[model samples]
Each structure stands twice: as C-alpha cells, then as structure tokens.
Target: MLQQRFFSATSSASKYYKITLRRSPIGLSKDHRASAQTLGLFKLHQTSYQPANASTAGTILKLKELLQVENVDSIPTKEQLQANKPDRGYQVIGKKI
Candidate 1:
C-alpha cells in the first residue's frame, strides 16, 4: 500500500509546456500568423500553457523561431502570479481620530 501511494503521488505531478511569444508575427507569412493565433499567442511576450504532448510539440515547431518554450512541472495560479508583482509606491496621509 505504501508503494502504491508513492507511485500515485509521483504520477500525479503534471507536466506543462510554457510557451511564450518572443517576437512579433507582423509582416510574417500568413501561415505563421495563423499558427501563432491558433496557439493562443497573439501579442509579444504573451504566455500560454499546454499539456506536454506530441501534437502541441508539432504546432510549436511550426513557429519555433518566434517563441520561447519551457517544460514546467507546475503552473502558477493567478493569485500566486499577482502576489509576485512589485508594489507601487504610495503617497497618502491619514489622520487618526
């Protein structure tokens, strides 16, 4: 039972492909633009995550020159990402009653 639990825990770890657009697709061939849109990346520096699979790999290869790809084991949550942002400086004065 212990061995089975360990195996399941290890298998539950997911693998995702973190794909980021590194360059503009403007003025490129129509096919390239279509491929980028199809992959859910339309603007420079935008990121999309997809499962690590053969079909996604093929699509990525089609527009590899304009993208940055990395294999990540986990995806960060929206709140987690927001928490990492730099805080804005504040200018405020308050009077206590």
Candidate 2:
C-alpha cells in the first residue's frame, strides 16, 4: 500500500516546460510571431514556463526554430523569477516629497 501511494504521488506531480527565446522573429510570418507572443516570449533570452500538454506542445513545435526548450520538474513563480534576477547596480537617488 505504501509503495502504491508513493508511485501515485509521483505520477500526480505536474511537468513543466522551460522555453527560452533564442532567436529573433524578424522576417517571420505574422502568425508565427503571434504564436510566440502568445507563449509569453517577448524578448530574446526571456524564459517562460508552460505545462506539458498538447496545446503548449503545438505552440512550441510551431516556434521550435526560434526557441530552446527543456523539460523542468517544476515551474517558478513570478516572485521566484524576480528574486532570481540580479540586483541593479544603481538605485534611484531622488524622489518628489
């Protein structure tokens, strides 16, 4: 019973895809660019997480030539992404009181 429960728990965990835009969309068709935009990739080297499913798979396949994809065990939340970013070297020095 314990073994069965463990297997089920692992199986129920969701899988994610890490997609990074590696190429520019210049000269590409409007539809292809739109598809990439729909996938939340707006800039070069930007990464987005999406579930491993048919629709997402189709989108990735459509833009495969312009993107790099990897299977990730989990997705990072927005806060996590922000936290992972490096701090800017300069801070705002003045503000209206």
Candidate 3:
C-alpha cells in the first residue's frame, strides 16, 4: 500500500488546463461571475492556466457554459502567452510631431 501510494504521487506528471473565457459574465448570476473571477478570467478570450485539481475542476464546471477548456501538457509563461497573439497587421508609418 505504501509503495503504491508513493508511486502514484511521484509517477504521474502534473497536468494543466488551459481555460479561455468565451462568453461574457454580464447578466449572469453572481456565483457564475465569481467562479469566472476565481479562475482568473476577467475579459473575453482571456486565457488562464490552472492546475488540474478538484478545486479547479469545480470552478470550471461551475462556469463551463462561459468557458472553453483544454488539457495542456505544460503551462505557458507570460512571455509565451504574449507571443502567441497575432500581429495587428498595421503599422504607423508616420506620426505628427
């Protein structure tokens, strides 16, 4: 029993959930809004990484309607997250002095 517990605890790599806010929380119940906030989703299309645990699972379930979730192998750093965004495609050629 002790060996099994130890193996289980150490063998499995930690997983992360990539959660994106697909819908607005406006007009929803306070509980829904609070759940979204707890998940670190404050704006539309905002993505946040959360550990795959009971509390995080509960929060995702509570606001599942407004969120899109995917299991990610690793969590992304702030720089990586920013880098994933597409360029606006427009550049300012000249500015008034």
Best by TM-score: 1
TM-score, one value per model:
0.73, 0.67, 0.70
Instruction: Provide the lDDT at 44 for model 3.
Output: 99
Candidate 3 segments whose C-alpha is farther than 4 A from its true place: 1-14, 82-97
For residues 63-89, write the lDDT of model 3, one tens digit per residue. 888899998889878899789998878
How much does each candidate deviate from the true structure in C-alpha RMSD? 7.3, 7.5, 5.7
lDDT of each: 0.88, 0.90, 0.89
Candidate 1, residues 1-97: lDDT per residue as tens digits?
9978765646545599899999999989899899999889988999999898778899899989899999888899999899999878976688678
Question: Which residue pairs in candidate 3 have backbone atoms (N, alpha carbon, C) closer than 3 angstroms, thus clashing?
Answer: none
Encode model 2's per-residue lDDT on 5-60: one tens digit a residue. 66565655559889999999989999999999999999999989899888999999
| Model 1: ten consecutive residues of lowest lDDT | 5-14
Sort by TM-score, best first.
1, 3, 2
Model 2 vs. true fold: TM:
0.67
Candidate 2 Cα RMSD (Å)? 7.5
**Model 2 misplaced regions, further than 4 Å:** 1-14, 78-97
